[model samples]
Target chain A: MTTTPTPSRPPVPGPPQDTSPTFVGMPTFHRAARAALDDTQQRRNLHHATRTIRDKRSRAVAELPHWEELRRAGAAAKDEALDHLADYLIRLEERLTAGGATVHWARDAAEANRIVLDIVRAKEAEEVVKVKSMVTQEIELNEALEAAGVNAWETDLAELIVQLGHDRPSHILVPAIHRNRREIRDIFQREMAAVGRPAPKDLTDEPSRLAEAARLHLREKFLRARVGVSGANFAIADTGSLVVVESEGNGRMCLTLPETLISVVGIEKVLPSWDDLGALLQLLPRSSTGERMNPYTTIWSGVHEGDGPQEVHVVLLDNGRTHVLGDRLGRQALRCIRCSACLNVCPVYERTGGHAYGSVYPGPIGAVLNPQLRGTESDIDRSLPWASSLCGACYDACPVGIDIPELLVELRSRVAGDRGRTAESVAMAATTWLFSDPRRLTAAQRATGVAGRLVGDRTIRSVPGLGAWTNARDLPNPPPESFRTWWARERGGGTREGSGR
Target chain B: MLEPRDDVVPSEPRTSGQRVALFATCFNDTLWPETPKATVHLLERLGVSVDFPADQTCCGQMLTNSGYGSSALPLVRRFVDVFGGYDAVVAPSGSCVGSVRVQHRRIAEESDDDSLADRVAELGPRVYELSEFLVDVLGVEDVGASFPHRVTYHPTCHSLRMLRVDDRPLRLLRAVRGIDLVELPEAQECCGFGGTFALKNADISISMGSDKARHVVGTGAEVLVAGDNSCLAHIGGILGRWRTGIRPMHLAEILAATEGTPA
Candidate 1:
């Protein structure tokens, strides 16, 4: 592989520290989401992009008469892979070793980053170009490398914008989906010159010009960087193959041009056979980009003598995936392909954007997946489950049939179980006490009716300590007489319930 | 406003012997009695006798959905105990029936009583949202009701996604005499009244609800109807706040209307 000189910079720092756009200490989903709802420009951007993609995805999915079957098949394959995950992983390691790729096991993000940093150090490389990878973001690999004084340049167009703009990915498939084209143009004009090659001085907000600038800035780095890092869409055990699908060909360059290549893949990404990829390949493109097929799908197995990278290292990362797999109901989240179909259709995500989720994985999937992957100990993780309105839109749109609404409720229960008594919990307890028996409910309703008579049909605009709802929307006063009271007094003859059996 | 119809005359000649119970669903029972009252009027007009089980109160959906599955257990048993014997249990709310059909069994499975689980499963199919009961089980496209006004419908998320009750409400509304039924843009979207979700995540809820309100008002229809009253209350609250001169109505309320009935 061709190599060029590393750009001269300051000396390196010690080990990796957690500096990769940490979502830590974010406010609760309600508070954070409430704040995000005020950004009108960002909301408009999300509205346009999500609506366009959602419509296109629906049309693309509808073209195949057996689309539902394909979805089920995709789900079944992931389920099977997860069921026999240990076997597949062991088989994958053996096959990868035999095929000339070295396999490394990482129990968590720190171990995974250590392995990657060691490889870069062994190569004596100063910088490594990277393909767009969520696992890398999840593990904060770039921040780790940067802390160790190694430059990890992102090559994907959206990723490059996110990196340069110093912004976290808002959507999975479209990372910078929260920014409109004009905003992207501004980011490119203002930020590119500080980091690398300067943008065209008279650059207008044309799409082609922006892409050209990105291409121009990335091409030299691709040819020069001696090391590259990537994450795979699917890792097949039978053939010991890693597949990276992308719309841009930058992934191909990153995979091949670098002499030493390292790939970080989640253990849950393992599929038993290449045969399973057929249905998944169909489902992912249609669900994510609304494409019949991704423009570029690179399937690499270890190394060729002189054709591709001379050395290949694959990191099988557990990174709390096993913790997620242990829960019966929560385990279904492992079936996700990161296609982002749920994000496009979620009304809450459309309004608040993905930052409100406080994780790289945002929208409905993030709400369930983050809590499982990173336990519910953190404020953000605990709040993630309640971010959704239980609309079931995510479940219907999910290609894997994950039943996200079911999982959200399950996670909510898990969160509640972990907490001590609070005002909300006490209120819930009181409600349960009141609702358990019909007589109790009747008594409460009678009291509520007496209160209702005092208020009549007047609206309550705001209530202190209950302003979460009343501050936004007015509430109708309760009716003076409840349905059961009316029924008991008027339809007075028979207790048609068989008197509670 | 909703006085009980003491003059019990079955409008249609046909009558079924199926024992039916009305589950007004706690929210409707307390806040919007007009919905259940209309349901009673509509069902009785179609010659199907209705019964209100005095022991029936809440379906425990609010508890279960609010992450209090254990707290919701007593009501779960209470539901099966009171309505399990009936041939059909009808509710004016889609979300309540949806909870009965889906979430109750989930919570019951965790309760670890195989018998209760089995009974919950058996009862799930018998539970029907108002639109489903009126359209499918009753096998009536036309209830011979008149609603002489322009109306648009918002299919609540539970009815649209969970129950997959596609076009049933539309089919029912289309059959109403003198009714000018207009289509709503993004009608299938949620009104953001996710039970306690409004209280919990209120800003995002209001953001979503206002968009739904904008669409409802943009339709230029006098009434915005939906299967769930909670959603109606939320969207109606926004309409009322904006002084849009439009009001939200439940599907049962519109279906129960007739020439002699008050609008």
Candidate 2:
């Protein structure tokens, strides 16, 4: 017998809105993840790469006996900075000005972008070389600069690969992490020429070769660019110094060589004291790239009169951070040090790749961070919270004690309860009502157990309504008798053993 | 760097005035009765009394994790009402206990129910997942069971990370006589049986689950065991669909098996 077909999805609670520019008009996470899951090469690349990195991180972290103390200190430093964020910001600005640096405050992405664009326009530079920055990507500074006829060149190797390939970053640290070496070779061969210097004609998939090709291609842009833009990993409030950490020396080049330099920093990157930096330094490199220390750590307070960039500008960006700070449950996300350890460890991030998150920040941290940074009004932001299995692997890997699973669940509550009742929420409400009382649960179980008995012992290969589950996996037929029923009949339910076997 | 808290793990069963209750959990009650039954047998063998509170339905995990935090408040209250008197609450699930400990508190505080929040705090540590109950609280690594077969244990994500019951199940399995326990490759990775995640992100979940299945198959173990039946059901479904000829047994099921009793 045939039955009526029901629509697979109930109505979405809110209108679908994609807030991030790089992935504008992107679908919800599951839809995008479904597509990413189909890409066999990407899956293999992510699986191998993440496993290698995860193993390396474990070894690196094992070396530090006092790693927990440093981690706690780092988290405490961030919390302390965030607690008195206003005071720190004022002190930071004061120190920066005293050290002969200019500073700008941006309340939002538009303001941040505007501030950067105005700086580039003032310098009259056609192109500005950039240190790899999640904040810059968050504000879509390249797009903003490009729109105003100013080119923003990503100087970091991974960011450069993403820029040259015209692909959105998939991971926070390794932006083109979804692309294997072969794909990177292809990207360099095909896309690098149009941007700057052409890739070598005899380019292979060798790592060293790819580095050489990128270095050679960016050589001209580095020399030609007069202005540099960057984002700091840590902005020390005490000395007003901005620190940029990198494996490659490209961040250093962007920090010093340009005649005019500007740094776009998140207000949350503040470290309360110089003493706090070493503890965080120990945690970050070990957690981030599994290195004892990053190859290059650039700390510049201000202009040093012919030593570095003649002029320096620091833009302190809010950009919805205050909104996140207001949320007691979610404020811990601000403690993130931009370490991709969570991304590397996440199984969901491993399977789906970063594009599935549809934002600059992806992985477990992104799942919690994106919603708070960009409100849950958008479909992608709303769906981000559900992107995980609530696996605490991210939290386990987090060096800064950002309880990512807790944050994800908290954000999920905001997504569910803060909105108008959807079909899913109504269904959850029904289950909640049934489970609130044991009798209701027992009565329902009894009815289901009776139905299950009638269905017999056959495994359920497929269910018409739940094709998502049954299409791939087979569920066991429910046992004929519920545990409660079995206990009541044979073991005398509710009879206490009371210290007697 | 959460410090290794393995010291908190008890190595033998406690024999005293402590009262124990089994939270069969909604899923195990209706679908997998054998697991809870095996749990009872295993506990009885250790001279520990186990009580099943008839009023215990669920720990409100499904509702809370599904984003219905407020809706979970009633069920949270229901949980306290039922299990509040027991000295220790045990379940055959790590995820459920993680919820009762983690999400229940989040729900109470998020909804601003001060009394419920305090009750959840008091109740959190008393709740133990199976492996934790057996190795950490009961403090017994061996439950006097003999399973003569090749077995591989998949440490459920919640058990491995959330509950941090590292090596407890393995220690229990290691103590079992006539058992060849091979290490599962990439065992720390999730099996991808994330409730609605299996439904919503079906493709990714399948990808992750199938990979886990591949690792489990590579072990050449006759039985794939874990603490949570929910994860087993998902992994076992893939194993079943693929006709891998492997059985998915709960940890308690294998531990409860004695001479001439093959689980």
Q: C-alpha displacement of A401 in model 2, angstroms?
A: 0.9
The runs of at least 3 residues in candidate 2 whose Cα sits more than 4 Å from the true structure, single-residue gaps closed, are: A1-18, A493-501, B1-13, B111-113
Pairs of residues clashing in candidate 1: none
Q: Residues B1-263, candidate 2, lDDT per residue (tens digit)?
A: 22223333233448456889989999999889999999988887777788897877788788777777778888888898889999999999988998898778877876667888899899999999988888777777866778888999999988888788999999999877789999999898888888888887888889889999999999999999999999999999999999998999999899998776657
Worst 10 residues of 2 chain B by lDDT: B1-10
Residue A249 of model 2 has an lDDT of 92
Error of 1 at B174 (Å): 0.7
Each candidate's interface RMSD (Å, one decimal) is: 2.2, 3.4
How well does each candidate superpose onto the true structure, as a TM-score? 0.94, 0.93
lDDT of 1 by residue, A1-501 (tens): 112123133112222223135877878888888778889899889999999999999999999999889988898888878777888888999989988999999877899999999999999999999999999999999999999999999999999999999988999999999988888889999999887888888887788988999999898899999999999999999999999999999999999999999999999899989999999999999999999999999999988998889999999998778877777677789999999999999999999998988889999999998888878878888888888889999998898889999999998888998896878789889998877766777777778899789887677787677777777677787789888778876786647422221
TM-score of 2: 0.93
Q: What is candidate 1's TM-score for chain A?
A: 0.93
What lDDT score goes with residue A214 in model 2? 93
What are the per-model C-alpha RMSD values against the true structure?
7.1, 7.9
